[model samples]
Target: MNKTICALAAATLATGAAASEPIAVTAPGPQGDLAGTLIEPAEGKPVVLIVPGSGPTDRDGNNPMGVNASSYRLLAEALSQRGIGSLRIDKRGMFESRAAIPDPNDVTISAYAEDVSAWISVVRARTEVDCVFVLGHSEGGLVALEAGQKSDDLCGILLVASVGRPLGDTLREQLQSNPANAVVLDEAFAAIAKLEAGEGVDTQDMHRGLMPLFNPAVQGFLIDMFARIPAELAAGVEVPMLIVAGGKDIQTPVTDAEALAEGQPAAKLIVIDDMNHVLKPVEGDSRLANIATYSDASLPVHPELVDAIASFLEDSKS
Candidate 1:
């Protein structure tokens, strides 16, 4: 692993009695530098490299796409309080990593997986550890599985709020889940079918509401994503895995987690009943209520989430 330290800055994590100063870290990327934030607890402690989910989410888990919850940042702080270290990163060509590539839309799952391999090398060198655990949230989990297939250096794989089915199927389910989408369901389904068949959809005539999801700029990436079945990837991963799902999550439900665990029978699966897609605890079944948490930065990630991950990592060591 090459030591590519461009600059350093301090970030204080104020979580109860435990706190650690996060340092800015960078790894060499194709065009420029891939940026990340590392929170190290102590020497010899286990470290996790957190991969962000879909779209333009930053290292802190906030994105311009109506997501301001800071779930990843809060999760890192919670883990640090439990004596665990973490490094959360922005995806290549997005956020602080915008310089890594010319266009964020021009990417594939495999490219993201390669970036994970790069981050793992950086994490191992910085922490002086033999291997690092990978905690991938949402679509990032698929990247983890893809990386696991190619590398034997991972301590374990952690899938949080990730879909176990092929991305096309999951997209169909998500579109159908909302009653308001009934008017455009047929069009959405047809588009997904085309993408799954390795064909591009003409979004020029797509519904205004669905244009953002099926934008022409991202169709290439979506086509690549549609071809991947996460369950199949999970089956090929030759390492310990922890699959955590949120029961109240409308995006990727608990069944998706179960499918992953089913694919990898030896993997551990935990379902948190009240947790939403963003890792925040929501009380009811109202769709509006659940989506509200997506923009709320004050809410901390579910307490059980941190505990589940910490416990799984400790148990995996034995």
Candidate 2:
């Protein structure tokens, strides 16, 4: 454990906001160990497990897909300041958890939900807490919802920048939102339709840019994702939920949060104006300007987001 702590210390030091040393922790995985960083808050403070969003994102919230923003790491640090502990993990078959499975793309939402259950068990044992909060960002919110359906150990759920509709609908809107995608809009829409129908699409001769999104290796996962309607899942989650939306977010807009709140009338919803998809504040409506923040690790996550989450957790306890 000391070696693990030493190895991960530099990364934690970079955050410069964690109240204590970050401990490298592991949860059981299918074939190997799932890796995470656990930052314990002041004694008896509540703990949260930060689930990464889609893609090959690491525990720190950075990925090779042009996203360098350390959103999760910063969020963990900020929460620590609020006396909240956090454990942010690398998904199976990616980054430090690469050995957890043979392939990263061979996955489904259910599998991710199972991993969340495993992580919950681990956090409870380590922290000696009755339960832990689950904070899922973007696509991860879907995983959290699925996990909450069967897991009895969750304190509550926090959905951050998550989509409220089926992934296919969201993908369609995303494609249609950009004028540059006009050339491939028809094909992309067709592919999404097929996936939503539980069928696969032939990507042969497809646009090069579209291939990355619809690659055959990940088609099965897409099919599973398309089948899930986040609103429906939110309706099934019996635990307390906090849905946070960014007003300036282009990906999953405020409408999605509203939909989630509608699905679960008891859930609390918070909207942070000026926050972008990556959780950074964007002053204007420039799409390019908003995207530029995805690569800027120096930019802090929206203060309002941190405040809402901290307050929600505190309130959930009472």
Candidate 3:
């Protein structure tokens, strides 16, 4: 990987302990600048790179579309309190890196997988950890898997709310499950058809055959990536692995996590009770109420979720 020539969006500071303030750093990306938080470890501890799920989400896990849950930041703090450090990054040309691009939607998993390796090089230089752990949430789990495929800098991989099977299959299932989107179900089916054909769905004007959830650029990436499953990638990695899922997770369900462990002999799977897709507890069956928790920073992620990951990382070190 070529060394990135960068101008600091946030300056790198003296490293010793994990500071309360997350240092801003720019790493190499597919299009424009990619921003990240180089979360230093307290006492120069090992750092984990918390990869955000697929979206236009920033390093802190918040998106402009109204997802304000500081998932990444909170996770970093929880890990830091456990003496585990991490780096959280915005996807290429998103948020702070938005100025780094002309078109933001033209990105693929391969590009993101490359960026992960590049960030590891930049992050490891500033950390005291012998290796960094990758904590991938939702689609970011795919990025973590691909990154481990390329480099050995990872200490271990903790797949949080990741997909177990082919993503194409999962999306098709979700299209059928979401009632609000029932009318557009045919569009979902047609979109999948185009993707399966390895052809791009023409999105000149958002047609009835297109879902806003799948942009042309992102759809291209997903089609290529869905062909690559977490288990298929995990099949080659020998590092310590932890596959976590919330019992009620609507996105990447626990079955997916189970499928991942089935692919890797060494993986340990944990299904947390009362936890939903975002790692929050929800009452009753209202999917809307369940999704509402994604915005509540006041609520702690199921303590079990953090505990499971921390225990794995700590045990790996020992």
**Highest TM-score scorer:** 2
Q: What is candidate 2's lDDT per residue for 251-281, written digit by digit as tens?
A: 8989999999999999999999999888999
lDDT of 3 by residue, 94-133 (tens): 7766655666676667777777887788877766458788
Which of the two candidates, 1 or 2, achieves a greater TM-score against the reference? 2
Clashes of each: 0, 0, 4
lDDT, model 3: 0.76
Q: In what order do the candidates fall by TM-score, top score first?
A: 2, 1, 3
Decide which is better by lDDT, 1 or 2. 2
Error of 1 at 295 (Å): 2.2
- Candidate 3 RMSD to the correct structure: 4.9
Itemize residue pairs with steric clashes in candidate 3.
Answer: 17-41, 17-42, 18-41, 18-42
TM-score of each: 0.92, 0.94, 0.87
TM-score of 1: 0.92
Off by over 4 Å in 3: 1-20, 30-32, 99-101, 203-211
For model 1, residues 8-108, the per-residue Cα lDDT tens digits are: 22234454225467878888887988998988755446888999998888888888879999999999988887667889998989877888899989899
